[model samples]
Target chain A: MNKILSTVVLMALVVVGCVRQDESVIRIGAAGPMTGDQSKMGIDLRNGVELAVSEWNEKGGVLGKKIQLVPGDDQADPKQAVSIANKFINQKVAAVVGHWNSNCSINASTYYHTANIVAISPASTNPRLTQQGYKTIFRVCGTDDQQGGVAAEFVLKTLKPKRLAIVHDNTTYGKGLADFFKQVIENKVQVVYYDGIQTKDPDYKAVLTLIKEKKPDVYFFGGVYPEAGRLVRQAKEVGMAIPMVTGDGVYDPTFISIAGNAAEGTYVTFGKDPSGLPTSKAFNEKYTAKFGAPGPYSVYAYDAANIILTAMQKTGTTEGTAVAAYITKNSFPGAFGDISFDKNGDVTKAPYVVWKVTDGKFVEMK
Target chain B: MFTQQLINGLALGAVYALIALGYTMVYGILQLINFAHGEVYMLGAYLGIIVLGVLTYWGLTAYSLVLSLLVTVIVSMAFCAAYGAVIERVAYRPLRNAATLTPLISAVGMSIVLQNFVMLAQGKEYKNMPPKLPTEGFNLLGANVSPVQIFILTASILMMVALQLFVAKTRLGKAMRATSQDRVMAGLVGININQVISTTFMIGSSLAAVAGVMVTLYYGVVHFSMGYSAGLKAFTAAVLGGIGSIPGAMLGGFMLGLIENFGASYLSSAYKDAFAFLVLIITLILRPSGLFGQKAMDKV
Candidate 1:
């Protein structure tokens, strides 16, 4: 009877301690694919969140409380993303900055909406993500319609190929982007070949051989780096010397390294190059010093976290609905430039630009 | 187009054959499907990357590409052989006398363990292999045949031939055959069962390692999860051919590759993987013992 009484007292004390500790810190959630093919990008986004939280803590934090970041790995799967969303809700995170993949963002946003938690995806660009009427859902990146339209315009105006071949990896992001591209170029250009390849299969020679026979003037791939790298390399091996174009998914240093010489002269569409701006200089230096180089979505994730933090500071509360309302009403200056969400929770201005791989680096094409 | 697709199939089949040989050899001896065989192949590719990275760092690749490649392949094969032996001893040896299903489960557990181990050690990103060979090759008939494809085909064939000769001629080979035929009788006849089993794993792992190296070189990329799909296909090949027959494995590998490529070329690329499994299902229904497997009868 004495031992049981003491054990019950100890459990009570531990629970109280946890509740007390949770009260003094504002918890922000960061979630993405931390242990799969897209992990590098996920880690980059997480690091951006960490940097923002640390900077806030050093400056006495928001609402006179220290900031804490809770990281969750969704592995780029929709089902895993829903579970991660539930975990974040259970943890009582004020806001979430993550879910790089479009499908994951779309799936998890419903749970976040029900829990009244704000989710600001830094990389997911599918337009339907914002069109679902979830007031709590937001993103800092350009939507796929804008990005794909820019890529199509560039291909039609600059390359002006007579025949085009479009391929996708059949994921939500890839297929969505490819569909947007196809919509723009549907009647303008003759789509000699269009198909979806299984991602991570690592053998695209057979498919590339089939595409080669079609004799398309240019090729466009709608996928992330892992598949795009191999597809481009295999395309070169199959004697297809035509130029290849893709969207923001292929914007990474890993893609260049994977494709080697085949990466040269390839075209990629992403948000305007902010690294050349003066506002981004300090962030770039600090990020590069800590984690080699910022990935494609690093700055966007940093800006997303900062937006949440600033909104909380301005509202003087960590409540999700209030912070989200503040974000929609105003603009926040960031490393990427002025960021303000429209009524649909997308960035007001979609600044998509064409970048060419030149001499082993992504150089903005005029 | 037909000729070109055939060449692609052949190149792909060569790697599958090399990996299938490992699966078949281990199953022949222990009658336990070594599901971890694919992880061994993945490790071989990583080992190749490490060795090749070192060679390139030392600038030896610039001095002589041939010598550098030879060293990389040999070192990777040697490391994978030792790794295979260790896995067999640790994961399989204790379960040898247990229920058959027990060893198979252990094989799966080992596969997951090795995959996670590599993921934690090397990271989740794909590692880029520095290209040491020229991508240029001559046009064959109507298809473009790269030098790397030729090397993969030639090297795989040479290794298969060498493995056949080793199994047929060596004294150790005869001991392996005896043990596979009847373990108790072979043990009574003074054949070291444990040593023969270890040797079988070593040889099989070395062949898988060779396949790993070839794949990394050909694709110019390597990832930890690569072994899963490759292993599944290779295991399918081993079963399609008689599981215990060496030549049958080679034939199965090439046939599966051709089926996949031609299916992708003619019918649809989306159903390429389905084609290989379709053939496997049909073959199983027609011949339950597999294409080359002999029907066994229990002795009363």
Candidate 2:
């Protein structure tokens, strides 16, 4: 009889533990690659989300409850992204701001739509991500279609080379950007050499030599910072000194550091510098004080988190469908400016600008 | 273009040969592949960065690039050698008499552990090796070869020659040969089997360290996962040349490098890695014992 009583006591404690976890707190999920090669970007995204959540909690949170952040690391992979989405759904988070990679965002959006949970991707740029028509999916960044077209316009009007060479890392984002650029410029100029390179290989001399032999007047590469750095460095090493242009994926401080002196004279297409705007001054100062400097996508992540929090406050409830519906129908002030999602769940006004690396710094090209 | 690609292929092959020697040496003695060997090479590169960073801070690099590089290479090689011995003792020595699969699994586990450990300690970003050498190069038939590439090729060749001499002429070398030939007989002759095995690992690891340092100088970038693809290619080179033969490994490394460069040049560059494996498959089917491997025989 004494043993049976102890067992009954243990079961009561378990029931109380589960109930306490769900009481008086609003949970928001943040997903990104918190580990692996892209962990730096992931950590930056997490930091941005944390800053926004903490600020909300300091303001007494939404509906008189404390705010909680649930972080999931997808490791920048698609399959892992689906698992993270399911986990967030099981945790019953009101909204999500995450999935930095385009592929991850695209894969996880299906589950979020099925569960009626809102997910706002801060950095995924592939056009297919928003083209899927998932009502629950949203993004703060511009699509590759816009980014690539901007780059192509710059190449044709500004650089105006007779022969151009295009290369990509063969990833979803890279290939998509390259293809879009090609669609715009294939008839205007001669594409001397076109190919895809394996990411993270660290040796591009073979391909660089081939491109050098072709004698293209300008070279364009569609990839992230790591491969971009290596490609330019190796191209310089191989005596191919042509000017190179790339998409926003190569627009990080890490690229300059990795490429060293070779980074000079390279052009990158990205959104206009938002840190200099008066609206973002406070966010920049707070972020810099906490995490050294804001990473390339930190501002977007901060805006994404704030969008979710504002939607929750206006709806006055943590229900997924209700909050998502309110977010789609309203405009909210963000770190960049006023952000309004279109019917397709994309930012309507994302302006792409070209920046040049001059004297080891990325300067906005007027 | 052909000459330039040839030069590029040679430089890449030299590094692969350096790494392949480690795989070949370990397999020569214990008949077990050290999957953790690549991690050792990676650690060697990280060590190079740390030491080089310190030297640069003290202005030693500015004083003399050659001296600073020499000190960095020596220090990194020493540390990696010790690391290799510890790995062998803790992970491989205990399973020496167990099923061959046991140590193989342990090797893979150790590789994962080391890779993660470095990732955590170094922060997952790619650490740039501050360029100490001049990038200027001499042009030959429209192909420019940088000074750093020349340094890599010369350093690799010198170390390989030194290794060949050490193995053929030293007392320790003779004991290693005896142990590889017949461990029981060598132990009966009062040879210290443990010491011989440790020495082999030390030499192999130091060679890999040298290769690691060379790679950083050549590429000017290094990361935690750099070892995985490099180690895989070096392992392929070792098997293609003959798993246990030193000279065969060198020959195989160069051939694979040239094949990859030419294949990428003439065909699709995206399939660059695939070419190495294709050659590996054809080699395996055409000559099961490899190019230089002796035919297998059953003991009576």
Candidate 1 residue lDDT tens string, A58-133: 9999999889999999998999999999998978888999899999999999999999998999999999999998
True contacts kept of each: 0.54, 0.63
Candidate 1 lDDT by residue in tens digits, B177-250: 88888998999999999999999999999999999988888887889999999999999998888787789789
**What number of clashing residue pairs does each candidate have, in the order they appear?**
0, 0
Report lDDT per candidate.
0.90, 0.89
Top TM-score prediction, candidate number: 2
TM-score, per-candidate, Cα-based? 0.93, 0.93
Runs off by more than 4 Å, candidate 1: A1-21, B53-68, B120-123, B295-300
Interface RMSD of each: 1.4, 1.3
Residue A203 Cα positional deviation in candidate 1, in Å, after optimal superposition:
1.2
- Best candidate according to lDDT: 1
lDDT of 2 by residue, B205-264 (tens): 999999889888888888998899899999999999988889989988888889889888
Q: After superposition, how far is residue A354 of candidate 2 from its true place, in Å?
A: 0.8
- Give the per-residue Cα lDDT of candidate 2 at B187: 96
Candidate 2 chain B, run of 10 with poorest lDDT: B291-300
